[model samples]
Target chain A: MTDEGPLTPRVTGTVRIVGAGLLGASVGHALRARGADVVLEDASPSQLRLAIDYGAGRAATADDAPTLIVVAVPPDVVADVVERELRAFPDAVVTDVASVKLEPLRELVERGVNLTHYIGSHPLAGRERGGAISARADLFIGRPWVVCRDGKTPASDLALVEALALDLGATPIEMTPEDHDRSVALVSHVPQLVASLLAGQFADAPDGSLRLAGQGVRDTTRIAASAPELWVQILAANAAPVVDILDALSQDLAAVADALRAPEAVGARREVADTIRRGNEGVERLPGKHGQNRRFASLVVMVDDTAGQLGRLFGDLGALAVNVEDFRLEHSPGAPFGLAEIAVAPAVLRDAITGLEERGWKIASTTND
Target chain B: MTDEGPLTPRVTGTVRIVGAGLLGASVGHALRARGADVVLEDASPSQLRLAIDYGAGRAATADDAPTLIVVAVPPDVVADVVERELRAFPDAVVTDVASVKLEPLRELVERGVNLTHYIGSHPLAGRERGGAISARADLFIGRPWVVCRDGKTPASDLALVEALALDLGATPIEMTPEDHDRSVALVSHVPQLVASLLAGQFADAPDGSLRLAGQGVRDTTRIAASAPELWVQILAANAAPVVDILDALSQDLAAVADALRAPEAVGARREVADTIRRGNEGVERLPGKHGQNRRFASLVVMVDDTAGQLGRLFGDLGALAVNVEDFRLEHSPGAPFGLAEIAVAPAVLRDAITGLEERGWKIASTTND
Candidate 1:
């Protein structure tokens, strides 16, 4: 919807979103914005009415025959819903937005459902909370939408899903179901487990030590606050791939623990060093803002803990023509000021420093000056 | 230095800092700003000269008699340096800013050295990099500086260390050396190892999967980019406590992995749910900004990817008299705009949304509306 030139959505015919949760309502809102007709359905009548009232779409009717069917249910019931939709709308191109792709696809295939009308798709976008009330039309904008396909997947069926992604302002990525599951297992599922396991260590921590918690542990365990109800289903459905990654991680953890236990022994220190070094390399592989793999030069400035101080600081940056690549605000307990870490291009680091300093800002640190 | 009520420093006499690294140079700068005489020393000549050149302090001289000694060295050499500093300045009170305290304290006690004038203290403050060049005078401001003591410690000697902490604008926390080590092991050391061990799993991950990484994994693995040399030493020094936590974590991880592997088994799903639920509870224990254990309401607004857009948005908030508690900017791949998630007090959430919407900002989502 942010794009004005394209009033015509790529998706055509009547689009149906089944399940009025965050993703379903969001999809309905997006398709509706694109001048496409959308019908909504949910197992819960109250949820369906809520999405409809939010202007996402209208309630589905018995005569409604959708050209595209988006199955937006939980992972546990994805295959069952997809099967029902495929049978109900025999000619419609059916796709799903479940986090894990393979298990549902395999289950549908096992149920001997018709293969011509089904494709698996997932949009790598979400909010902390779920429900129709939290839906946003622009949620998928700029996010990746993976379309899972195989040799038997018809081009026309795949095209409908890709068109949905495009109309919703998402980048369409073509991947096999196996690849999708494996990739998410590595990037998403296992990391959730790791964060949870790490946060769980805080159970026995005394108040004195917990008081010393810094930004490092906070960032490392931030995802541990996710809802367990949703995670249990996601992890259970992708158990094979998740287990593979966790088993490997458990071994590495045990090795590091053993090395730390006898650090003065031959190669013990080396083993510990190797693990952290490998981590440094692994983290380096992640792309930065806007899908670029380049690093940003970071500088920290001290700001008084008062209202409108950040506004004035950012206003000065804008007036100085400095583009902030990324920003984070760090506050110490009982400190009268906060440290605002601004990331910018390496070439503009000097200008940002000179301009902010001239504007009466205190520069705490700059990286690789 | 940000506080200008008085020029006289609480810390008295010629304070000698024996390491010219980040902590040492920062301590020197802060004390110098407070009009305290400081003498500097380092094993490396260039490092010592660099600290002096950076306006930290004058180099140590043969006749330099210090009333206080701060041993700011690495963890492995902490005891050795502390022993020498205590012996060299027999009349002066000595302290070291080592990350781990129990091992060095035990080693010094085992050496049968006089412990009356020595204290183990650590300021929980640091930058990602080390050395004099990256040091800042306000490093310890608003941070917790732990002072380790036992029954034999004198009140006068403890007062000197506490005054030093007050001079640097850090809160003085009293704890036993055993408690300090165990606390950091739970909060800092274990989290570091967990990040490293989890990031190490990316060795065999395909690039496609890595590209699918979202903010969840990015935050969870952020600290994995830390320098390995420092962590190896910290982990090694705090081995016993760290191993205890890791052992417990290893057991929990093994249980979750086993549960996921056979999710259909009795109570298997419950096991997985319990781990994440425990994480939820543990993360909830961390203190929020300014040491308050409170939650903030979050709302997301769409901002066009342009210079000064953020400035404009924040300016609007400031003009509307809305104070932002926390903010994060998330951009999607190939998206023309970014989502700005602003966290504010729940009472002011309605005002923020209404004001932003009236100013032509697109409201993407709101919490618990």
Candidate 2:
């Protein structure tokens, strides 16, 4: 996600960021580019300096009375830092960008902290690694930045967070703290655990078995490579919701395994089929590029596995005025050619094939489904 | 995989193929293109006719004498079809392409069907849907063809199957029936089950949760869309081995769930960290595009979401002689630009970045790793 519109300032006033890690520095960078004043602080002096050197923002000064405060810290220390920030800047509207919403909010509430100016928000954006060095100005652009509001939250307070989201080119989605926690549990937390669990299966697998691995296992386990230290905190902080989803997943897994173990038993195969069909339906629910996705028709064309061969094909598509909705390159082991699977709107599929054929391209699949 | 080298047929004399499903018709198509005489048969007359009309092969006749027969029936009836084919052409070296090998081999042995001539093989190749309508002549190209052998099997009989694999542009790897079934169980069967189970969780999930779904969930569940009817038979045939792996996975899942449920417990976070680390190691074992893959350095460049922008980038790369090893297009919702994450060799990354920058392309990620 990148900021594409005119780079004019939208957010006003001096903003103080309490951490200078990936998320913190990214927020500073985005706001700084919008011509707003950003003051950065961090427990690590080197980190704060590194972000300043990178032109994300200036170092914090004691005399600076910030109008806004963004607390971007690790999940374990989030509530502690948010509590300190609220007390330090009583009049400033405070927001924290932590993965989980309810735990920190609940912690702040139990501690009897005045959270009238505090808002819990999460921007669903990250890279594989995190650091001030890895921060980007456009990291949150075009991503969903969830803004959590409670009954006590003022309309003016919510507007400030929304403006920050929009200034970074992120879509601001309104959700309650409880709903936000549960939603992320289902979407992010549980999926991380599942991927890690599935990938662990391969650790002990024979090399021969691994040699046979295909795109399926690779895709299912790709996210398992995220840092364990970071995930341990996220999972622990959001334990209840994550556990709820994991328990449900465990039950489904057990039933399917039991059915496979006794295939001849009545309705055993039926149970397995239903579970798989449920997965098919589940995947269809994901929103596509434009909206709730209507699958685009795909065509697999063969391209010579050289530098310029793909360029020739894509250049031809550009010439044909065919907008490729999605595309993936499939390189076969020890093969001279690679398959380019391009998805397009069905209306243009026939013309795309016709045009490519006219250009002497070899179409390997005419399945059209 | 395309037949890039030559059009010469390696296997001599008339070849008979039983079953006109995807694999059967594809074999016919590849063999016919090599100027080899092929006779096709299926239990259903209409199916056989469709294969012939598609130019896969001519229909079988009673007078036809075959030197080799390929049994490409479903796993459930593999032994029956192989037994029939063996009786019809006793002198011919026969092979059957079935997903599970041990069961069919044991069945054929139990029924006293064959003492010689039959070879059990499986080509690690398939599309989302099956049928002659989806068959391609190059379907077997660049894929692994697992050939199972026994002490009693003759060298000449094994040679025939290997030759067929080579002719179809596949790499033949010799494996025992036990090894083949167990290997496929680890890489293919268990993975399919995990994907199905994970996907099933989303079937009842809230739309708000699914809207927050990202690429990790999308990749992990993509294979959940496979045909459940076919998987039921395959999973049933390999029940014992699949259940063994699933049970192991269940234990891991339970341990992590228990740990997450009570984060304050001793060794709680350790248990979660270990599972995730194991997955990290497991995914690393997967082979890359090149032999035992060394990761290619990647650069994420922003492109306009409209048509032809990618063509320009690739064309520039081609001109600069920077071979793009791999690429994926990242489209954002309601954003004017997309990101092209291109993987190239580390040696070329510096030059590639410089050249692209000179060409006025905005490189989003400077993190080389």
Candidate 3:
């Protein structure tokens, strides 16, 4: 089981994945694809056998000792299964892929298990779907694989977890368990609740009101389709941070509500405007293309319905040695008029705008608004 | 004079759209597409010529009289423009396509303009781009066109406006000007603020934080890239209602936040859970598939790496006469598993689930989640 220079790396010892569910099977598929020996374990023999039959892993007997153990199960059962697996494999580096990190990390430590080999990890990739048979080798590719490195995590444990993440074609992001939970609470948990609440409005609306819904309502409530049980666990675990953000949001909403009741109050309108303005400020701070947190350049062009006019406009921009980031088109009926909005980098904004204007294009100016 | 048959209606003159901007052009386009005679007027000769050239209308001369006049201009200028257009065309039934209604309506009435020929309408449709060239005839199709029929609006004026909306292929939604503003504040204005605030957080995020973003961040902040000035005007105009919604949200957020800061505090966690649970309840209320407020049935099936297993599974379901509304696949790492989430009509859920399980497929229980 060895290799030298110019030879392929020897197949590593099997990495045992308990549960053989979505996360567990994904790990096996990824590891197996990378020439690592993978072993799958599941209480459901049918599920386990399917994983083996699919070449996700070799069938693991009770006596098999693997190099690593990845615990992938429901959040409530993660602690119990992780502890059992740790006991089953005293030497392997054990990690659990759970959404909430700190609670599980603390629970394992409190249980007085061997902490040196345990590393907490969460790969932030998921779909509305669930379970082992859904596992894909490339599922984690290009996604962030968060590795929680704490005092209890040994150097070998960190290295092995990092290696595992790398092997699965994931980017290893080092974060504290607490930080991970807080970040996710703000970005994921709170948003999900917001989306759900917004969508829920339709449930109580009269039939007539529901029929009036357009694309805006649809887009705002898209994430409401998430699994309720899974989301409940996520929200519960990240309760504190999510509540903090919501509180701030609540204060903003309260101010807005007051303004609506009596708009003539001088400062009332400003107060409401301020909250919306703050929202505006907050939204602009989000990252853009390929993770660049830069302002988008908007180009407004007026066109007609000559077939291929849009394609020609886009083609012309491409020929001008300018990169078109993103564009949206607006057409007015009977007017045979079209407005095309194009997003570009900030550095190129002025040049692109001026260039388009020079080409006989009518660019909408924000200053005029 | 126009000829008319028993089946063919009497001659109706053009619906004159003033300003020939994005909104006006869109109105023109929609009307023209629906076989309505349209003519547009703009103070700027270049814009007026452009509107005519773009086929928004056959050139509208100052001497021309129309059956309807649509005033489409900026919010601040709406009242003055509507008044001027009313004075200009005494015989035409008039409507101003403005976002904020009460202010403009009050301003026009106070000026002692002829009230019998005028109504206020707002078609809720737009794109990021603007101006006459951006107009598309189909812009208002299937969208809610609110007719603000106040006590002063003549019955004839209201009827003509509703007829115009029908010709433009828009769903006529009747509401008072005040109610329209308030409703929009909750649905449209406040959401813009929320999206903006979320995006603003990334405005100064550290490089590392920026790199860690995923699809969630992208989606939540998509609307943040809107026109700043246009939003400013909208917020300023409807500050009262937006403030009201924001204030209400703030109160809820504060209660949740207090719960988070003291997780061990007895009722704190419960309150947070309750709020989240309410959010869950709310999200489910949203209309699903073709305007029905029914929960779609979901079946989660475990899958493996067998070639064409998914294709065959879908085929098998099809063969079983199951109509799958929607489906998504997610792979679980380490588990060598894949989970497929399939949506169907509620009545078909149990049957589909049983069929899949009977075929040796391990389907997770829906109730468990």
- Per-prediction RMSD in angstroms? 1.3, 1.5, 9.1
Spell out the clash pairs found in candidate 1. none
What are the TM-scores, per candidate, against the unseen true structure? 0.98, 0.98, 0.73
lDDT of 1 by residue, A204-247 (tens): 66777799888888889999999999999999999999999898
Q: Which stretches of candidate 2 lie over 4 Å from their true place?
A: A1-4, A366-369, B1-3
Q: Candidates 1 and 2: which is better by lDDT?
A: 1
lDDT of 3 by residue, B1-369 (tens): 011123221225778888888888877766765567888878788887877888887777776878888998888788898888788888888888888888777787788877677788888887767878777765665467889876767777788889877776566889878878876765667666666655554454454544556555556556765766567567767766666666655556666567666756788656755665665565555444444554666777766533345545665576566765544454332233456666667777888888777777766434212
The TM-score obtained for chain B by all candidates, in the order given, is 0.97, 0.97, 0.78
Q: Runs in model 3 with CA error above 4 Å?
A: A1-11, A32-36, A40-60, A76-84, A109-113, A133-137, A151-156, A200-203, A254-369, B1-11, B30-61, B106-114, B150-156, B176-179, B263-277, B284-369
> What does candidate 2's lDDT look like per residue over A133-199, in tens digits?
9999888877888999889899988899899999888899999988889988888888888888988
DockQ winner = 1
Residue B69, candidate 1: alpha-carbon lDDT: 94
> How many pairs of residues collide in model 3?
93
lDDT of each: 0.88, 0.86, 0.67
lDDT of 2 by residue, B58-92 (tens): 98898888888999988899888898889979889
Ranking by TM-score: 1, 2, 3
> Compared with the true structure, what per-residue lDDT tens digits does model 1 show for residues B103-127?
9988998999999889899999998
Per-residue lDDT over A64-150 for candidate 3, one digit per residue giving the tens place of the 0 to 100 score:
878888988877778788888888788888888988888776778799877777787999887666766567665675567889887
Superposed on the true chain A, the predicted chain A of model 1 yields a TM-score of 0.98
